[model samples]
Target: MQTVIFDLDGTLADTSGDLIAAANACFQALGHGEVLDPLADALTAFHGGRAMLTLGFERLGVDTSDVVDREFPNLLVHYEQGIDRHTVLYPGAIDAVERLRANGYAVGICTNKPEGLAELLLMRLGIRDLFGSLIGADTLPTRKPDVAPYAASVERAGGVVGKSLIIGDTVTDLNTARAAGVPCILVGFGPEGSGVARLNPDALLDHYDGLDQIVARLIGHPVLV
Candidate 1:
């Protein structure tokens, strides 16, 4: 079976706002008062909590990473409380997934987010049951860009690595597909806008309405319509 693996943040959904808010909460605890703007720093937020902490710390002229480690857990705590506060699935994301599943494509998520957080966010978004499988950052010994998690996600979703591809919004996702020797379809509608094309993915999806045809074209499935 053919499989379509998705990256959670900035791919199927815009999770940056809540992510940045969590990091800002950590900064606020230290009297920094929301050092990370949910709007301006959205791209950085998708890089993960550590990146946000490092960016905020740099703003405070603090060169040490010890504090970043210290505040990491706190950031997670804050994030869990409001995971879906400002998060929303991209337009046509669910519709695309449904159409693909209806057409016999295996669909799953391989996110760099922790397993628990990914599950929680999906459930909060009321889309958990839609995915056939989920491979998170800690699902295996290693994560994305490492082929292991990607392959695992495909297999668990009842597909083979040879007939799989990834839809994502980051370099990490591109690297993951490259390592897996699969085509990468990046979302041009993500936080980086059309700038993601610089990575030169196999295809750039500007909207989900055309995804059925794009996936079929790239993965060798018969065009759905």
Candidate 2:
């Protein structure tokens, strides 16, 4: 089966708002009081909890991974409490996935987000059942930019590794596809906008509306089982 694996954060959904809020919770608790601006720092938010915390610490001139590590759990806790408060699926995302599935493409998710939180967010958004697999940061010993999780996601979704392509909005996603020797489709509608084009992925997605065509063009259409 052909597989279409998606990145969770800025690809399928705009999770930056809630992600920024979670990181701000950690900084607020430490008396810093909302160090990250949800709109401006959305790209950083997609980078993950640690990145947000690291940026906050950097802003305060507290340079140490140790502090970010300690506050990570706190960020996760706050995130869990309000995961979907401001998150929303990208326009046509759900429809595009459904179209892919209907056209015989196996669909799955590969996220740097922890498994539990990814699961929670998907469920909260009422889109959990859409994917055949959910491989998160902790799903394997290592995550994307390493081919392991990507392969795992394709295999778990009952698709061939040779017939897979990744749809994401970050360099991590680009690197993952490169490692797997597969096509990388980067989203151009996210915070980085046209900036992602500099990475020169296999394709740049302006919107989810015509994603299936991009997928077919890059990797060939599914066999239509």
Q: After superposition, how far is residue 83 of candidate 1 from its true place, in Å?
A: 0.6
Query: For model 1, how does the per-residue alpha-carbon lDDT over 1-225 read when each residue is reduced to its tens digit?
Result: 889999999999999999998998888888878898888999999899999999989988998559989899999999999999999999999999999999989899999999999999999999989899999999999998999999999999989999989999999999999999999999999889999999999999999998998888888773345
Compared with the true structure, the alpha-carbon lDDT of candidate 2 equals: 0.93
Model 1 spans > 4 angstroms off: 222-225
lDDT of 2 by residue, 67-98 (tens): 98999999999999999999989999999999
Least well predicted 10-residue stretch by lDDT in candidate 2: 216-225
RMSD to true structure for each model, in Å: 1.8, 1.1
User: Model 2, residue 176: what's the lDDT?
Assistant: 96
TM-score of each predicted structure versus truth: 0.97, 0.97
